[model samples]
Target: MDVFEHIQSAKGPSLFLLPEWQNRCHLLTAGFTGRSGGVSESPYTSLNMGLHVGDMDETVIKNRQLVSDALDWPFEAWTCAEQVHGNRVQRVTEEERGSGRETLANVIKGCDAIITNVPNVLLVSYYADCVPLYFYDPVHHAIALAHAGWKGTVQQIAQETILAMAEAYGSRPQELVAAIGPSIGICCYEVDGPVIGQVTLLLEKLGCSDDSADTMLELSDNGRANLNLKEINRQIMIKAGILPIHIELTQWCTGCRRDLFYSHRMEGGSTGRMASWIGIRER
Candidate 1:
């Protein structure tokens, strides 16, 4: 039942209770991957959507086209950043589609998150270790997508994007339904002392509490702390005043499901990326 909606012969990573996504005919979003689909050989394997990952351009293009077709979107309406991993959040419009090509040429000036009230403009971001966050305020019919690595998370990109939507589109935080996409979870995210300290400090500044959340933490073999990024972002969303019930964290971990996802740490630099995208449709 979790088969790829695009090809009769395709399958995706083991899905985990994405029924909210599957049931909503108008719900514009999806994510999670492993080694099953795509046309790239060996390293890239089957469903690699990244154009810059040394996969054949046409192959990547085809995978993209397949995704677009699966979602009933035009292939050309997709947007992505060069991903500088900064705190900048770009407000995507009708004009920014296809701006990422190379490390520069079609890339957005500098940004880590993207938002739009525009319909059918799917936003894509690559990830192997960082977290993917999605925002949708159906009341305003708008959506925002973000990538938060350690640096961007400390800068509170999720909170920033929510505020941006509030300012530009009058989207209320309570009306926003957020989804924490599949990412490196506590089981595989081992980090050193400084990052732990920084994350802790930021969590405090954001007013997150262990009391309100039933989250778990672990220490890796190297003594680095393993974190549940989905939970971390969920707490940030709560602090931003978003309704708790409206948030969904995909109960899947990329590193654990390496057969279904593209992990940078797992596949080295030669692997491709699985893209997470969300968008509104023109009413």
Candidate 2:
């Protein structure tokens, strides 16, 4: 089943909520944003959640505030990280609540993954075409968000987030529930030789046979291959011990759904960003 439920509303940000997780944990709210229902101009158009992408800072804040209001979360709880396409994971605390919500100046620096057991601190990461990785450990009440572009995927950001959660909150991978949110899919994501080379190395490390690897990275006649990033991240999550049954994978591809999402590659790099967020409300 498609777990990212799209909520069509007349006001505020249009969002995709993870209903299963919310049903399991009443206080938890998690989802991704769409491109409609915001104040930004073209390129950013509307509902742009990224602050560093040349959008008016205040306009970006307004868009973010809309998301917070729609979630009924205080804008003060919106925390973020400056994704550097690396495997570094930052363990957020109460003090880090609301960091980088409005500007890149205070964003969690050089981190692609952010994990926290701290309540009332909403963890957010921006994305455009790249995969948005979600992790939750009900056993420890810990939730995390990771940004996985090809570089981060090759570096195993998913595993890094899992290991960080285990070290910080004693979250066992077996007890963790994960989700791969909207991103580019194999049909719309073609890659060149350099990317194929790195992905080849990672596939070998994952012990994928040529046939299986072909499904994840299929070679084409044009000296390029289509890469299924979402699937690769799902495999990484499983390799890290997250149960297959506990993971939810979304079929919405950013590159394919340009009307509903902002695709950097599809839009030729002049695009806004959607946000993937997860947080436990303050009790």
Candidate 3:
């Protein structure tokens, strides 16, 4: 749960590497550079991997290569979506690899979530403010990655991934270990009237008491309220049958920690993206 600071290098922007991922199997780690880690001059900083963003294509390519070299994993190992913000889940295979800088139209079908049973095929989804959910099933030898924005959260994208694993790879929710990666936490994720109402409806449908959900959230001095996105997603996981003990959450908020991660809410669309990826190497 420690936040690692960025270490500048003359060659390129280096990410604060995680010790857990060096040789660990069935492990998840991503506390890398924020918008500032890389060779990009301004706006995109140095490590922006988002192709759709307005950053120069060559700069994005250089940044992606930097991230791949820093992690010591092949750039082709990661797969991402155009991210339509839906409930669809796509299965990843060895054939889908090799996109050092693949165009969006080439790889992005109609999927928001990705799962893989093949070793070394990492499933990745980009984020500036949206929550990324990572899952691993040691028993079934499977993995799933999901992007859960408010709409996707309400649709329970995490639950859908678990269900997909069960159907495709015989993975059970109870056996699946999950981690809700860094994103815009409730402390910084303010919503308008309709958005709150949407969340309220989902919360109620999930059997959360109306009184409790409403009461637990209170306005700050300036009238801003903190809503725990991790907690709510955790509730969805449990209701879908995952045990509480198998879940992990980070208190890091993308908006709050702008120096370590990107935040769309914090930087009004002129921002780079932070990516979370997970893969199981072959035995």
Scored by TM-score, the top model is 2
> What CA root-mean-square deviation does each model show from the true structure?
3.4, 0.9, 3.1
The best candidate in terms of lDDT: 2
Query: What are the TM-scores, per candidate, against the unseen true structure?
Result: 0.86, 0.98, 0.87
Tell me how far the alpha carbon of residue 270 in candidate 1 is from the true structure, in angstroms, after superposition. Answer: 3.5
Q: Native-vs-model 1 lDDT? A: 0.72
Q: What tens digits encode model 2's per-residue C-alpha lDDT throughout 1-283?
A: 5789888698767799999999999999999999999999998999999887899999999999989999989999999988888999999998899999977888889999999999999999999899999999888899999999999999999999999999999999999999999999999999999999999999999888888898999999989999999989998998999999999999998998998999999999999999999999766
lDDT of 3 by residue, 17-104 (tens): 3334333453544434456657666676757878788888778777777777766668777667768888898877677764324567
Assess candidate 3 and give its lDDT. Answer: 0.73
- Of the two candidates 1 and 2, the one with more favorable TM-score, higher being better, is 2
Clashing pairs in 3: 38-46, 39-46, 40-46
Compared with the true structure, model 3 gives a TM-score of 0.87
Clashes of 2: 0
What is the Cα-based TM-score of model 1? Answer: 0.86
Query: Over all chains combined, what TM-score does candidate 2 have?
Result: 0.98
TM-score winner between candidates 1 and 3: 3
